[model samples]
Target: MTVVAPPTLAPPPPPGAYKDPKASAVASRAWRWLWLPLLILVLVIAGASVVFIVDLDSSDTGTLNPHSYRPDGGNALRVLTEQYGTPVDTPSTSADALKAGLGGDVTLLIPDTAPLSVRTIQSLKALPPSTRVVLLAPDRGALHVLFPDLDFGDFPATSPVAPNCDAPEAKAAGSIDFDGAGYLPKTIHAAHVTSCYQGGLLLVSDSTGPEFALLGDANLLTNEHLTGYGHAALGINLLSTHSRVEWLYLDQPESASSEGGDGSQALFPPWVDAASLYLILAGVLVALWQARRLGVPVPEPLPVVVRSAETVEGRARLYRRAGARKLAAESLRGGALARITPALGLGADPDPRALIIALAQRSGRTTQEIHRLLYSPPPTDDQGLLALATELDRLVDDYLTQLTIGRAGADQGNNPEGPQQ
Candidate 1:
């Protein structure tokens, strides 16, 4: 018995059949290698974020930090004082200042009052009558104890103002930088206070008792503004009046441990505990609700089927939107060549020159023109790409038509139609 082979409709798809993409791509060694760098990048970013947050609360690195020479630092002022023979001593806490200043001859300069504990405030008020206390604008919290008769109010900007009264420091400094803390003297004790800079009482001095001096703002002493107005001279004269200077810089907020306290309840704010309880109750409710519906997962085939052609179109649209005409033209040329190769009886992976020659002979086109169409450098713009695509489609169609006609003629010649035999 004799058997005839079926007519070839299309070529086999480039060796391997359509394979489902590996679902375990993430588990593959190549993917594992790619993820290592990404994981490292994420860890690096997280570490940087934590460092940035910690740096935000630092005082030694900030403008007002005595040791820092940065634009905002008090390094210039510190150097100036040391030049005048009275070196600035930085004490970590209020207790350290009190211990050093107990000699009465030592001057205590509290640059910031944010970290002052309840005990520190009380101890400062009862310092030796001989010790002088210079405080840079104490916040509203410390104002009650430090300035018993002063009311905290808006601090408005003021032009260079002279010391109108007999206060020697004010008069000697002559037109000083007075844009500082505003104080409203409310009681009989505050009547003796010397005020300056409009509403801002830049200095409040009491010479009879433990002398206390209040500055309006700390900016006057920073490196950026130290040379402006009479800031440098005033800051130097004010800090150097004593034999020794103790610059008390409070770094952190008053801790519960320092107050002799323990446990989260005492350490953290009350609202934090209440919020945590609500969150825990919500999580428990969600868990209980989900537990009722939990069961063995049922296996099912995918309901929707997406064709590779749809993916190709989507990628093409993206390339078009991004103006990636060169890449798009190359893809169009590759696809056209892939289909044209089989239609011309040239097997897969045929040499480009040979394929062009064969296509030219069958389609009655020049070899150079065919070569340019298939393997030319990518088109410059979208318009050129569109024209190239049209040419490629026409070439493929012409070649396919020629192939069909040639095959029909060969078939007829092979089996000749003889007279009725």
Candidate 2:
């Protein structure tokens, strides 16, 4: 008996089912080589981050803090003063410095006043007359805030220059790092402003505010240059003359007006956060507009019909490609059993034991053997799966033939008038 599959037309599977086996193999191979590059990229980024942090901590830039061990830091000064029984207190903000330097003899030392705001400068200027305020490299804005009449002027190259006149700190250091910008007062307040460098004074003391000392250059205060010439002596005499030193390391201000001249642009840049929000909102709206359903789908007839033989061949190829021999074997056995059960006059949901018993009795085969063939573990390979499918078909066809012959013989017996033509 022959079991031939007829032509059958059915809808194609969903798009996801049509994956190419070659493409999957290529993707797996690509990942094998690609992971190394990704790892290298990550390592490169990490190395760059480490270098940036190191560069930021370097003392060549103007950053003075006792906590920092960088070349520009005041760690040496801080340690020296502590040894001499003078403790240095470092404050981050202007308000904190004022509160710390409330005593009349306290010296408020500002390493870099470029970061100070108009508000902080005003607050610093309001300190007591007895409390000395030391400023290093005060810019135009700072000079304007501290000394309203003083103007920035062109100065000669910094050199080891004498005090030339009697100022106690300058005379003590003898020669110092005086190479920097100078201040030119609109009106010569001779008693108040004392010029030390050349044309403009390296150190200035204004009478309007506290005993404010304005030094031209900041390099002299750094850890690298502190030991050069009279730098250390100058720094110590200038800062540690008082009992306590209030070190104010004013970083960039938080408020907009303190940074950019234009308040609106500094506070809220038009192209940054605001633009990003608008872009995100626009993208969401576009997605919603495109995704909205217009109407229900209409069913349409397929353009071409695919034969069952071709479909079966395609499915077999797919199963082999996926290494699905076991799945293929199970499907074939199930199909054979479905056809055979009905031929034996059994219901669709007949018990498996009963069906096996009926098949065994009719074919004169052992119940165990029939059960093993009908409901056994799936085949391990493609050759084994093909053999199982052929065996199932032969067994089912033979049983069906026997059942047909038995029905014919029973009809002849009931009529008793011989076989009807």
- Best candidate, TM-score: 2
Model 1 over residues 1-421: C-alpha lDDT tens digits?
1233333232222322222112222245476587889899999999998898888645367647788778888889889988988978997656678887777887788777778876677677677767878877777777776666667656565567665655566556667666776666444273256665543544544554457777767788889989988888777877888888898776577653453233336768879978999999999999999879668999887689779999888997899899877657766876787777776666776655556557777776676677677666668887888899899999888778777777776776677773355
**Clash count in backbone of candidate 1:** 4
- Candidate 1: lDDT over CA atoms? 0.70
Tens-place lDDT per residue, model 2, 1-421, is 2233322323323334333323444675698889999999999999999999997765333467766667787788777777777778887556678776665678898877777777677777667767888888777787776667776778666566667757787778777656788766444454566666553344544555567777777777778888888887777877777788888875555352542244446567667878888999999999999999789888898789989999999999999999977557666766777777776677876666667667776665566666667666667877778788888887887777766767776676688776569
TM-score of 1: 0.47
Q: What would you estimate as the lDDT of candidate 2?
A: 0.70
Give the CA lDDT, 0 to 100, for residue 355 in model 2: 71
TM-scores vs. true structure, each candidate: 0.47, 0.50
**Model 2, C-alpha of 272: deviation from truth (Å):** 24
